[model samples]
Target: MRKRALDTVFALAQQDERVVYIGSDVGQGTLQGFQESIPERFFVEAISEAYVIGMAAGMAMTGFVPYVNTIATFLTRRCLDQIAVDLCIGNHPVRLVANGGGLVYAPLGPTHEAIEDIALMRCLPNMTVLVPCDAEEMERAVRASLDWSGPIYIRIARGGESVVSLPERGFFIGKAIEVRQGEKLLIATTGVMLQTALEVQDIMARAGYNLGIVHFHTVKPLDTAWLANQLGPYSHVASLEEHSVIGGLGSALAEWLCENGDHKLKRFGIPDRFADRFGNQAKLLSYFGLDAASIAKELQAWVKPS
Candidate 1:
């Protein structure tokens, strides 16, 4: 997914002279094609994440669209001031391609984990938060970011996630895609959690429960119209994300529900506590009760037989 998004940025650079690629302490051969093709526009800097963000903001002011790539934690947590003051304040069109979102770096421990990235990015003004489910969706998000008006934060997962998004339904920024249609219950999700939601949907189906699924790739500037419309018919609405329960997709839904409707909502995400254990991504997800089986079990408890 990360490679595909970077490739899209390279392709966009080929077509647009205003496009630039900046990396902060990345691997030696990272975006090598972009460097070789457009040496003047490519920048590889050291461990200075704040400096990189300030530089990207300055380039945006100069009418250049800069795509900054780095670890998710460094981009969101390390450069919060620069992101808030430089990018969000002015509404720059800088594309932040964040790698290792959620628990993708679980083996590297909590410092490397980006569990709060969504919440952090969503709180900033003029920041568009996106969590693509797979490489295909990542390509679409990257392509769309080229024309998007403000600072865009694209949260990328570890590669080889299942492709749950269909091309036929099409991809649109700030639009929710309904992957499955049913009644009584709605399962709204973002990022790679869509895959787990789909699995849970199938499990519930086999057990005689119909689960509807909505995929929200674009978190901020959320598809409220779709959510508001779809949520009305269901008796229960649940939000699933690979992020914290606070200030993420689930929280966003909760906030919306308070203003719009009186629907019952169950949020499934990491608790508001640091994951102090070291393990693979899959293990950590299961440990946090985000695996498909655990999600299905939770759903079975929430939506009882009529």
Candidate 2:
């Protein structure tokens, strides 16, 4: 997804001279390509995310569209004042292309993990929070952010993901995309968990249980009307993500449904515990019961009445 986003920024920069790519002294691999392509427009700051955001805001003041890239934790957590005051409050057209969203850096420990980025960014006024499910969606998100008037926060995983079905054969901002149809349960997911959701859908279908999958590419400004119509009838709902349950995708959905619509819902993601051991991505996800088998089991158990 980062690679696709870099390509997207490059393409957008080429077409519109006003587009600029800013970096906060990170992401060497992807930044190399952007520098090689558009050296004049790309700028890398020295170890200061706050300054990077301030600089981007300064550029935006001159009508330049700057897409800042860095790890999610540092980009949002470390420099929120700059982000909130300089960009979001001013409604600047600065795009924040954040990577390592959720626990992607689980082996690197909790400090690097960006579990609360979504909630933090969503709380800021005039900020658009987005977490694309795959590379294609990432590309679409980049294009969508270009036309956006205010600051945009795009949370993405470290690597590529499988392509899921779109909403009725298309994509739209501030709208929920339904991936699959099921009768037994509904799983609404964001980030890389869409892969696990699809796999769970297949396994449940084989077991004669139908399910519905809603891929929510847009986290903030959630499509409550669409969710109300789609999830209104379902008796059971499971919101999944790769981040902490505190203020991520699941929490966002649960809050929306709790206030505006009436529904029974549960969240499935990394539990409210920091990982004590270092391991690969697959092992970390499995440790948190985010794997397909665990999710399927949870869903099947939910189907059984207490």
Candidate 3:
């Protein structure tokens, strides 16, 4: 997804001179083709995330659409002030293309993990938060966001995520897509967890229970009207995300449910505390009960009472 977004940025810059790429100490050869093709518009500055954001804001002020790229934690946890004051407050058309969202860097530890990035970005006004599930969807989101006003926080995994998103659903910035239908349980998720949710859907189907899948690539500015309609048919709901349970998709749905309806909501995500041990992303997901089998077990246990 990260590769596709940057590639799309280059593709967009080809037609529109306003589109530019900015990065803060990313890996070698990250966008070499982009830099070679458009040397003036491309930038791979020093490892200063905050400074990069401030610079991007200045560039945006001058009518240049800067797509700022960096590690997710550095972009959000380290550069929140610049992002809020420079971009969100000014309503700049900057795209914060974050890498290593969630536990993609589990091998690197908690400091690198971006479990609270959604909580940080969504709280800011004039910031459009997006977490596209696949490479195809990343292209769609990046292309669609060109004309949109204000800053956009696009959280993406390292690379090679499952290609689960469909073009037939018709991607939108602030809308939810109902990917699959079910009878009783509804799994509302975001990011790469859509693949886990889809697997859990099939698992439950094999167990003689039908579960639906709804993908929310756009976390903030959530499709509330669409969500309200979806909850009526299912007896229970599960919000699966690669973020914290405190202020992610679960919290967003909980806020809507507070004043609107009386529905059962089960939030499937990382606990409030940081990770203690680590391996690969799959290991961490299993530890958090976010894998397909663990999620299936949770669904069975969560729905057995009703």
Worst 10 residues of 3 by lDDT: 297-306
Evaluated at residue 30, the lDDT of candidate 3 is: 85
On lDDT, the leading prediction is: 1
Worst 10 residues of 1 by lDDT: 227-236
Top TM-score model: 1
Off by over 4 Å in 1: none
Residues 1-306 of candidate 2 have per-residue lDDT tens digits of 888887898889989998999877765566676688779998887888888999999999999999999899999889999998999878999999998898788789888888788889988999988898888888888988888888999998868567765534555778888777665478999877888998998878777777888888888888787787776447788999987888888888878878876567889987777777678777888888889999888888778521
- Candidate 1 vs 3: which has more lDDT: 1
Off by over 4 Å in 2: 27-33, 165-168
Over the stretch 102-211, how does candidate 3's per-residue lDDT look in tens digits?
99999999999999999999999999999989999999999988888889999987588879888888788999999987767889999999989988987888777878
lDDT of 1: 0.92
| Model 1, span 1-306: residue lDDT tens | 999999999999999999999999988898899999899999999999999999999999999999999999999999999999999999999999999999999999999999999999999999999999999999988988898989999999999998877878777889999988888889999999999998988889889988889999999989999976777568888999999999999999999988987889999999999997888999999999999999989889888843
List residue ranges in candidate 3 displaced over 4 A: none
List TM-score per model, in order.
Answer: 0.98, 0.94, 0.97
lDDT of 3: 0.90
lDDT of 2: 0.84
